[model samples]
Target: MSILPVSSIYLIIDLISGFFELLEYTFYRRAMITGFLASIVFGIVGTYVVIKRIVFISDGIAHASFGGIGLAFFLSHYLVFSFDPLAGAAVFALISAVGIGLMSKKKVQREDTAIGIIWVLGMALGALFFTLTPGYQTSMENVLFGNIYMISDVDIYLLSILVVFVLVAVFLFYHELQAVSFDEEFAEVAGVKTTFFYLFLLVIVALSIVFLLRFVGIILVIALFTMPASIASGLSHDIKKIMLYSWILSLIFVMGGLFLSYVFDFPSGPTITLFGGIIFIAYTLARWVRV
Candidate 1:
């Protein structure tokens, strides 16, 4: 009753792998190496992203970076300037994070509303600029829903360096992060720089989102960032335990989805997201039943 040729799909992937082995000296093989590195970085960063309750902001940052992507393309094409789309994305994402943090200080609007407005406006600007620039649509489409097979060795190196930076920063500030997440007022009274930690966390989330966009794309990056942590948080009582569980869970989803996609001729992003969603739902249901 299934429409898919499951067996044939596996055969095709096997053939593809064999072909890749034959072309092992080529740049395409380097792309796969970069992809693996990206996957690991996403797993670790995603844990903190979910723990901090910044899923909405992560989505906004990812979407907002589209404007930067557009600008990068326009500059590279029209202005004769060589620009890296990821670099531009990182810059804009950091700017957006700062704006979001400042807006949080105001009581006039909810944080969610501010994030939504920024998200839409950023996307609109991206679209407008893209339309004005020739040959921009193709580049935007790729950024919107990444082509994983195009990853490069340079990309892998950059991602690994960023991963190390994020991990070290988190390790150094774990207590402050935990305090701010649990209770901002109490954290401030206890001598934690709550505002600084909050801003730092948002900046990290923004950078993670930008890094992940090349692998999962803007549409599904939020799921990878939030779902594993959401499920793990439900099962763990302590923040440290939650982060540990979340990292394990994220790795499982990435490895499982990547393998399954290769076996089933499916897209990687949705496969990972779907598996994460299933696990999250199952965990929730089990908790409900136990309670």
Candidate 2:
């Protein structure tokens, strides 16, 4: 007997057909390219994120990035020169990442509380600045929730540069990062600069959050960042293997989620998040039953 329910089997068939029909559009192709590029960095950085146990910090930084976007708008209007929102978001996220890292290191506030403070402050600042921005902010929802179908050629180019940077940086710093991630105290004793590497990792994550903002938005980006590595970790304990597996799983989830959204006329970002969640749940259950 077929393992899937009959209705699900039919739905798959329909999705396959609809997916092909939609592929003729330039937007769909761009979305596909975006997925491929984003998945690489997601898998790499996410592995570190999961292993280092910093998912919450990543979320805080990602959300905090919106303040940068809002500031970009304000600056453009306030100073009378064009300011890139992505640039604003990048700068904002970096500051948040450094702030969170420094605060967590200083012992003045609990890490979670520090993260929470930045998260709240970011949202508040973004809202205040956005309200002050002149005219209707046509792209506001896109920043909040993401719209994959609206990606442009320039966006793809920038994302491509990010993938290259993340890949090369990780490859060069892999041993130091691995050391610091697994043992801050030991790494420090062993001559690894734990503080520098720790903050460096967060900086990369900040950059990744800014670039990923366009695909899944601030609201949904954390799921995209964390889910792939979490799913891959369930399959392997080796960090290297986990990174590779995370990339493959990310590709599957992104393409599958993209096609499903298009086939059913669903909202892209949330649909992708839910799609990953379902697979994650089913995988966990299967593993539990096996154990």
Q: Pick the candidate with the highest lDDT.
A: 2
Candidate 2 collision pairs: none
Assess each prediction's global lDDT (C-alpha) against the native. Answer: 0.75, 0.88
What does the lDDT come to for candidate 2? 0.88
Clashes of 2: 0
Which candidate achieves the best TM-score against the true structure? Answer: 2
TM-score of each: 0.85, 0.92
The TM-score that candidate 2 achieves is 0.92
For model 2, how does the per-residue alpha-carbon lDDT over 1-291 read when each residue is reduced to its tens digit?
Answer: 456799788878877877877778889888999999988988999999999999999999988998899999888888968988899999999999999998988878999999998998998999889899867376677888889876889889999999999989888999999999988899999999888999999999999989888798888888877888998998898999999999988888888889878877987888888998898889888888999
lDDT of 1 by residue, 1-291 (tens): 355799778777886676557446544454455445555555556666776677888789888888888787778777867889888788888999888887885556799999999898778878887888886666776688765665666677777777888879878988888788778899999888788888898888888778777677777888877777788777778766776777778778876666566557677767777877888788889889999
Clashes of each: 0, 0
* Candidate 2 wrongly placed segments (more than 4 Å): 1-18, 134-138
For each of the candidates, the C-alpha root-mean-square deviation to the true structure, in angstroms, is 3.8, 3.2
